[model samples]
Target: MAAAAVSSAKRSLRAELKQRLRALSAEERLRQSHLLTQKVIAHSQYQNSKRISIFLSMQDEIDTEEIIKDIFKQGKICFIPRYRFQSNHMDMVKLASPEEISSLPKTSWNIHQPGEGDVREEALSTESQREKETWLLITKWLRNETEEGVKTWQAQPLLLKCQSN
Candidate 1:
């Protein structure tokens, strides 16, 4: 009976630790979000990237919509990554406009996803001509502190030549 009791206690401790870890993760996400916002805004590459491709943030570290809104305001061509089932890889989809993003499909976790029609064929053609571009993927630290997380943003933006329409 004593051994069983000890085992139960260990399980309880594990559960508590897991819960605390989740909370810490949440806090870290918030910190990274703030820092990433500042970094993306201040980074010269981000400001100069006329046609930028970004992977959608899966973590709470950054909210993709907020970032998109700021880029939209600057009149930059923003492309967010979408999971392509057939390709088994993420495909960057060009957003028609910021106004249409709110209407995107939502997953069970309430994550917004790009619909099939949101992808522009012309953009795909353009992307095919160029290699992968420099991008950012924000990450968080265990302590939830800004600048403590990973520097996912590239220092220099990749150059690509697109055929004129």
Candidate 2:
């Protein structure tokens, strides 16, 4: 009974949050996303990391195009998730340039995903050897409270492990 209640609560909260995010105006969303990108770019972890795994933004989420461009500008490798239907999992594909992203097809879920042939063998091998290094994963969170006050939505970097081995 407790588990069921918790699950229900979580579902309701997620729906409410998604609605709130959808309500954000284009200008406000762009402003917040730019600020968030600036924060990540200025962080030492992002600066030192050689490879980063970042998600392509949906219509309602923070736009990561600027961050991706900056990463390439800084000579860092950028990767995005390419879902595999047979394995029911995602693989990281090296994104050499921002323009390449548009050439990919959209998944059933309406998110852009790289094709199976887009995998980079070199990146896969290097990921295993760099397990000890910090890698950035860009993600979004809702209703998080900060030192200043409550924030409705935020995009931030989360440290993640490399499972390429």
Candidate 3:
């Protein structure tokens, strides 16, 4: 009974968050996305990161186009998600260049990603030992603190924490 209640609560919270995200006007979303992109690019963590995993934003999510470009301009290795429709699996693959994005086809999710035929290096591979310890997964959401319970999604203007998993 307790498990059922917890599951129901999760569904309700997710619905509420989705509604909140959808409520954001296009202009407001763009404004916030720009603000976040600027902050992430300027952050010391981003400057230090040699390899980073970043998400391709949906229409409702925070835009990451600027950050993607900055990564290439700085000569940092950037990894983006490539979903395998065969199974419910998504892998972080190396993005060769910013220009590579345009030639890629869009998925049903309205995000540009490499097709299944494309071969790229995976982030979890044993190829690079130096990067084994350093990789940041830049997502649309951010946490106030780690190791402790999350305070909120937008807790900080730019929360550039390293993600090991």
TM-scores of the models, in the given order? 0.56, 0.76, 0.74
Whole-structure CA lDDT of model 1: 0.58
| Candidate 3: 10-residue stretch with minimal lDDT | 155-164
- Best model per lDDT: 2
Q: Evaluate residue 137 in candidate 3 and report its C-alpha lDDT on the 0 to 100 scale.
A: 47
Off by over 4 Å in 2: 1-16, 122-134, 142-151, 161-164
Which residue segments of model 1 deviate by more than 4 Å? 1-21, 25-28, 107-110, 117-165
TM-score of 3: 0.74
Q: Number of clashing residue pairs in every model?
A: 1, 0, 0
Ranking by TM-score: 2, 3, 1
Q: What is candidate 1's lDDT per residue for 15-105, written digit by digit as tens?
A: 8645544554555556656656777777777776666655455553245556677878888777766665556565666777777766878
Collision pairs in model 2: none
Worst 10 residues of 1 by lDDT: 150-159
List the global CA lDDT of all models.
Answer: 0.58, 0.76, 0.75
Q: Give lDDT: candidate 2, residue 34.
A: 87
Better of 1 and 2 by lDDT: 2
